[model samples]
Target chain A: MTPDPHRAHVPAVVHLDHVTRRFGDVVALDDVSLAVGPGELVGLLGPNGAGKSTLLSLVAGLRRPDAGTVRLLGGDPRDPRSRTGLGVTPQETGLPATLRVQEVVDFVGGHFPDPVPTPELLDQLGLGELARRQTGALSGGQKRRLAVALALVGRPRVLLLDEPTTGLDVGARQALWDAIREYHGAGGTVLLTSHYLEEVQALAERVVVVDRGAVRADDTLDAVLRRVSLRRVVLTAVEDLAGRPGVVRAEGAGDGTPARQTLYTPDADALVRDLVTTGVEFHDLEIRGASLEEAFAEMVAPEGAAR
Target chain B: MTAPTTAPTTPPATAPPLPAARLAWLHLRYQVLETVRVPIAVLGNLLFPALAMFFFVVPQREVAGDPVVATTAVAGLALFAVCSASLFTYGLGVAEDRQLPFDPFVRSLPVGAAPQLLARIGTGAAFAVLGVLPLVAIGAFLTEASVTLVRLVAGVGTLVLASVPFVLLGMAVGYSLSAKAALPVVQVLLFPLAFAGGLFLPPQLFPAWLDAVSQATPTRAARDLLVQALTGEPGSAWAWPVLTGWIALLAVLAVVAYRRDEGRRFR
Candidate 1:
């Protein structure tokens, strides 16, 4: 169950307006405001201590925000009806380790109106074989898979997952991605926070960058990436000549040794032409666009440029 | 089968909506089963007092009052129930729940907090009862300690009432300590309380100062109440009042601690 009361709603489903949560002198969430629509899958991205978990708790209706009102589905979070529409899988391992997979699924399913059948849910997550096995016997990846299945059994209108894949292997991570895609395909809204930049880029359509308990950027992945021009361009010879339009800085082996230079440029075509004119026989020439990772890093970077 | 053309009996009297009362009952039932399934709790509740009676009272055929033997056994078993349910099981279980992210899961469920609280209290009481029954049977059959129906019922009532304070105390302990730490604290408290209360050994057998300490312990008051109820003998005029006071004090402390812990300030 979520420890926050602000996260139980429908249209404008989750509202955290000027919410501030302080633990003694240290403020965990400082006047944070964010919202999710009925069927939007929003990815919350931040580094450690970025208030990602705190924000999720605020929306999940667990913790009461100190300075703000969080209305979920047009009702108070403590309202029983409002809770019926919400499902949460917190970062902490919530399942009883002694219980078998099927038992946990059944237990959680019993709380909802029309839950997915336990066997069917297990089969969907590729966990049918492990249904009778104790949760303690599962690997980290398997436990995560089971957690995802637990969240979905409720047929919830809004789903909250906190670091859903914190300890998953590469293959298991993609498996979870497929599951998330299927969930969105069914028009279910999802709110998630993850440290995995690639996972965020691949799964979330809209990204919200939080740092020091505040939203630094709330935009689409493309829009946020356009905010900064940190592209990696690998070129042979590249340039001894520097005057290229849109090129901020260029450095390379002007002497010899494959003559490669990295160009920090917004324009790739013009730089390529300048390289051609310089008559520095380019071998491996490729222009890489700015990834979400760099955009996220730039957004959350402190005054000292720390990620 | 008579194919009688019956009037449309209003869709065969559609079943009434599942009552909230039924949900509460089912939740309590589930909690009871889960609590009772713990083997150590069950063993301590049933076997501990039986063992105490076998070792302590059974060997001494003639004591100051052979009838006091039955009172001693009932008091021992009653205290055992309290230690198992209120201190050991309740404290450990609450710690486990706190560690889970269940606050979010359950907070989002349609279940009321009242039902959860009710289920916990009910489970603790039920486990205490299970612990007391075996000792009652053992005293009757093996020791040949005779207790009338009314006396037995009164003893059972006293045992249950005596457990209220312990249950509340257990709740406070549960909220105060993490699961790993709660178990050891429960064990440490159990022996001193059981011994101090004069449940296993009589107060006369203890040192003069220890007997004074026994008079203040909840276990002592509870034991006195059970002993009076069983033997039909009153020790002191203050016994009943002191026992009742202990129950009230423990109840207040338990609820206050629970309300504070449930506020989620620490989390």
Candidate 2:
């Protein structure tokens, strides 16, 4: 009965408190702390080897932390009772080579009391046609889909998906996203990791950006995007405007076109105010938030490098 | 963040855990199914001992005609079947399973490892029974090995008892070795233990030093006990001690191997 500071309110479906995990001399999670309330879809965004999978492994109860506590459903993650409501789809899945897709689902589902029907779950993941096929015979995308289907068959309250759509095509990735949304819409919580920023932008409500085995930024999706604080301002001007106040970089008119220019700045509002005060004749003015791509790069930018 | 619900903060309870026997049965069903679907997998264990019974015991009239010799041969090969199945099932099977991508998924289940580990032993026992079937059929039809009804029943029970140490020893091998090393290790251990234990030939035919050394092996102890069960004779005074000692030894090794594997993979 360790003291639970997190037990005061609605308990987190997944909670990690100052958790530090190590592999020999390397720290995979460095005194990290996170909590996901019930029904929250949080995306773990990081570069490869950023400890995203390691963190998920701790939550999934496949590994234990070197320090601190991890609670799943209010019990220690290592306990079987605590994991009953947890489902996980790892980045790489290995299915029994000879087992049929339906059978694999059935085997995993049987661990839970209220398992989804085999055929029904398969249909949801678009693996209905491959239900009878041996998992070894499946295409990479199909196997990945089946792996997600295995995670969902248990109807767990929380799903931990690591790189769920790594190798999927656009169509398959979309189908998988729809299935995930459908599950979430039904009141399930999801904590997923991805190298694909669009994947996070499309599905995550909250984002935790991890780098070098540490949490660099954790906030809502918009906040994480806004946290980079880089704005792209595009305007059509008769005169070049590359070196205006607050502009970090700009794509001024090329030799062939002088009327269009794009400028990037940290303070779009101040830049705009400066523009109007300076009486720069500008039309077609537009300001946009940093895309997650640029946001991630800037947030986890190399040490000692300019922001 | 706003609380998602006013529901109790307690962990979501699953339906009370399933009965242990039923869970074990579920695991056993798939374990057996996984093996049988690949028919060649079964043959790997059943083939060698049946072939031994065919080539070594069947063609010799004197060896086959004498009830004592023939019955001892039957018992020896029967033990071989158990050891073979136990070793390959745990040694090769468990090792290969650890390398599979599905392994972590299964290990993460709420059913815990008990049901699955029990089911593995159960599957090994079931297949061991099958491994003996060909030899048993050959003994009944092609040889003159004979016994009373009571001894026959006792022999079956004794075989089950004697198989325990070997099963535990197999698990040690299974948990400790990688799949690649398991095959050659099983082979290297299997034949020597079988030979030194008087499983392939009687200990009475061995040199004194070899005979003394054979007395130390778990397989030799098993053979002595099984032969005594099939025929109303006293096994060596060392039989129970040998079996008990090996069981304790192999149990420790198996446990250590299991923990080491967990440490390597997940710690």
Candidate 3:
């Protein structure tokens, strides 16, 4: 099997071409293609089981795609040499309970050609105090911090982190984010997946929204946010204006009595103009920009409809 | 403590990859440490054969005093110890590790599985040696079991070599089944195979039909070889061939089970 010729020209640190993965009858990833360039931080945003983990696994060489090729550092992912420059933190990792924090770090770091010292790695992750503690004794947040720390020990060229801060508190999450930012700043490519909209918004320069085993949108974070740039118009109206022009969706207590109706539209001004021209009786009208959460919800709504 | 916002400078010189021996030793050290911390696990493997010697061999005057009988009895028990260690350590240990999240992390490392498996086998062998110690002491002090230094050395060698099949069998069970199922399966297979192989009773005591059947089992082959080494007797003609065949079969099974498990979980 030959390497994908076009991928060589693109300087991608991680590349997948028409990758499809299935478990029995369920398609986990369907004809998905992605390329992450050197030093790029790409956030994979999706709900649970949205093929986010599957995609990361494929690139990490932890899983093989049912069809298509996965390349890491211009080498086939299945080769151990290809993983020499790769580091991954799966969604859940069970550290050896009996090994002290420092020993575990040292053991894993020893495998890499250029690994950060154990103490330095621990200090960077705010885990220095717990270095002597057995991993089984550490709290959930502390363990999460250590897991992320292990991913950085190798000073990998590209890091794959799956919900690195899932169980962390606000303070721990911030600390982890700082550590991640520092690594990325050092010219490391990173692909991270998260269900937390704020985490991606706060960290990712590029966003890939996945749902129902396919990429719904992939572009710069600002571009994706712009693509979902819809305003929500909420008001108490006496008539059902759900089918009004320019209104993408409208729902409320449409009982013919005056009740609050929330309408989603690409152009709130046009919806309001249409409402006014029709002489609809309304009150307490308010318009607000859609949040990233709302945009994410709209992106994945098709999956719900298919069900 | 607050974390450093700035990334540290890269090390001036990258360290070379550690030798496989060093990695295997490191793995062995940690595995031993972990098992030792759970003192009961160590005690269990150590005491079972020792207690069996004290109760079964120590009181039998006819068998305890005769050099040939005592030596054979002690050698058989030592092989029993190796079998137990091989079965429980790899079987239960691998099954338990499969349940842990840590196993995946180790599996994903650049270092291949050989070192880890070697370390595990080394750990089991170390425990197997420990398991035989009490029996050796009891045989030396309480019973009149005696052997030449060369015989003792050869007997130990035989014990270690004979453990290969059981170890592979353990791995096969561990990788093929869940911990819940593997535990009982190891236990269920252990005692019956031990009895049929004449680990507890002498093969001479078995009926002709049972003794003929026992000759084909790995356990029986192990016992025959160890006894031959210890007592300077000619082992059954079938012993070497039977053990070699079992080792070959179990090795293939172990590899298949390992690949199947890896495909199911990691792939």
Candidate 4:
């Protein structure tokens, strides 16, 4: 396939080529290859231990892949210079308890060539009111906000956040999402990992679902959402519904007073038409699109069942 | 949706990379600030050696009255100070840091590890020097520990040089173990080393076999060198070589431990 001319000039902000990482004998990442172009906001969605953190760690230069290459900002991720324009907040960050919030921001900022001023960065994160407070004194949500503030202090062109809002309350999560949106709106590339499907749905233009150390799907948010758009048809039926046309699976009582059955299908309308044509008596029909949670579960189900 | 798409808010004017020395200094400043905020830690590090002097040497009239003996005794305590600071600062401190998530964040920064390590050494040295002051005052006041300006300067220099092995050893322990294990390990290692090295009693009082074995340890070499610098008394022929050997060995061990820890934790 020819490279699209319009995209040829913009190098990928992150490139992982058949990368594999292992801890002892356990594979944390299995030959995962991904490329995120500049200005793309990609969400890495996965359950715990599904290699989300491992991927971010590789990009952040905190760990090396056992095989293949990881390039950040067009250079080897392991090099300090390669990470100079990158920022990361790991899943959990403990700030120095004795240092005031502002001092921590300044200290981290000092390492960058051009850093956002501490006050302005803190203000953006809604942490200005607590800038002078010792980090240990702040609530968990506040600490999380401060950690994110530190990540942005360098005015990084690419940001990698691993479960950035894991401990945050709803209000705090919203605020952090707003801040992240503003950054992405300003053309910053963001690759964030999250177990919260809603968070990813709200922020990511592209979604990569990872399961069992591999990417199950990587596409635009709408594409991924559509991939899991299967409908559930619930009804009471006297007939054996398992082999019905268009039904992926059906489970419930085949015979009972108002016999209950739930059939899963890619096309609920076609399945309903088939039931009608076959003259299968049914009642209490309900058809609904799968929730993102169900889509995520269905996506990761094979790995779960294999284990 | 057509927001003015000006060139992505240009980053603030890029400042030149801070010099390594300046970065190291900033780390030193923060390290000192963090430690000092806990007054008890500072007091504990400073008071132990001084208290040891007050109880051990001041009451021994014959030893205190003799300039050479008193100077050597004070020098031994000073060596003890440096050893304690090195052991606790790097040993316990490093292990504690390893448990904190903040450490990984700092380690991942673009500035590399040089500044952090140098800052650690600087902080340890500062504390070591500070911890010795009370012992020095006690020696000068309660005993006849007389030394020329040159001897005093050389003595201080010797104390710092002697701390290298202990500092590296502390780092080795810290990086290889958890905070809970490291604390007890440092405690277990420190006292035995101090006692065998003649910090508590003179090497002349050691049994023949004990004295022979003591000469092989870094602590003993440090104590011997400190006494030599303070009293102008010659140390054993093996002192410098033994110290150098221990420094080399500990340096290798420290590097291995650090790399192993990094591999295990970050990887």
Among all candidates shown, the one with the greatest DockQ:
4
Best by lDDT: 4
lDDT of 2 by residue, A1-307 (tens): 1223255676777889999998888889999998888778889999998999889888988788889999888787667777778788733457888888888888888887677778877876678898899888989888888888888777788889999999889998887887787777667889999998889989998889898888887888887666666898989987677778788666656554546787778799999999999998889889988775775676686555543
**What is the C-alpha lDDT profile of model 1 across A94-183, one tens digit per residue?**
666666789777766776656787888888788999999977788888888888877777776677888888877889988888887777
Off by over 4 Å in 3: A1-8, A90-93, A233-263, A274-291, A303-307, B1-19, B207-209, B263-267
Q: Which residues of candidate 2, in runs, are more than 4 Å off?
A: A1-7, A90-93, A229-265, A268-291, A305-307, B1-15, B148-150, B205-216, B248-256, B263-267
Model 1 per-residue lDDT tens digits across residues B29-140: 6565444445665676667666666666566666313656755665675676566667766677776677676545655565655556556666777777777777677666
TM-score of 2: 0.83
Q: lDDT rank, highest first?
A: 4, 3, 2, 1
DockQ of each: 0.19, 0.25, 0.32, 0.32
Residues A1-307 of candidate 3 have per-residue lDDT tens digits of 1123254565788888999999888899999988888778899999998999889877877677889999887777665567767777733458887778998888888777667878877886778999999888988888888888778777777888889888778998998888788788877788999999889978899889998799988888887776677798999988888888888766675686898888878899998898898888899999999876876687677742421
TM-score of every candidate: 0.75, 0.83, 0.86, 0.87
The 10-residue segment of model 2 chain B with minimum total lDDT is B1-10
lDDT of each residue in B1-267, candidate 4, tens digit only: 111221133443122345778779879988898898899999998899999888889999998999999998898888988898899889998998888877767766676555776788788888888888888889998999899889888988888888888888999999898888999999999999999999878999999999999999898999988888888889998999999999889888987777567523432
Total clashing pairs in model 3: 0
Model 4: DockQ vs. true structure: 0.32
Instruction: Give the per-residue lDDT digits (tens) of candidate 3, residues B1-267.
Output: 322322333332212345678678878888898888789999999899999898889999998999889988898888878888899888987998887777756656566555676677788878888888888889989989998889888887888788889888999999888788889999999998999999888888999999989998999999999999888899899999999999899988987777556423432
Model number with the top TM-score: 4
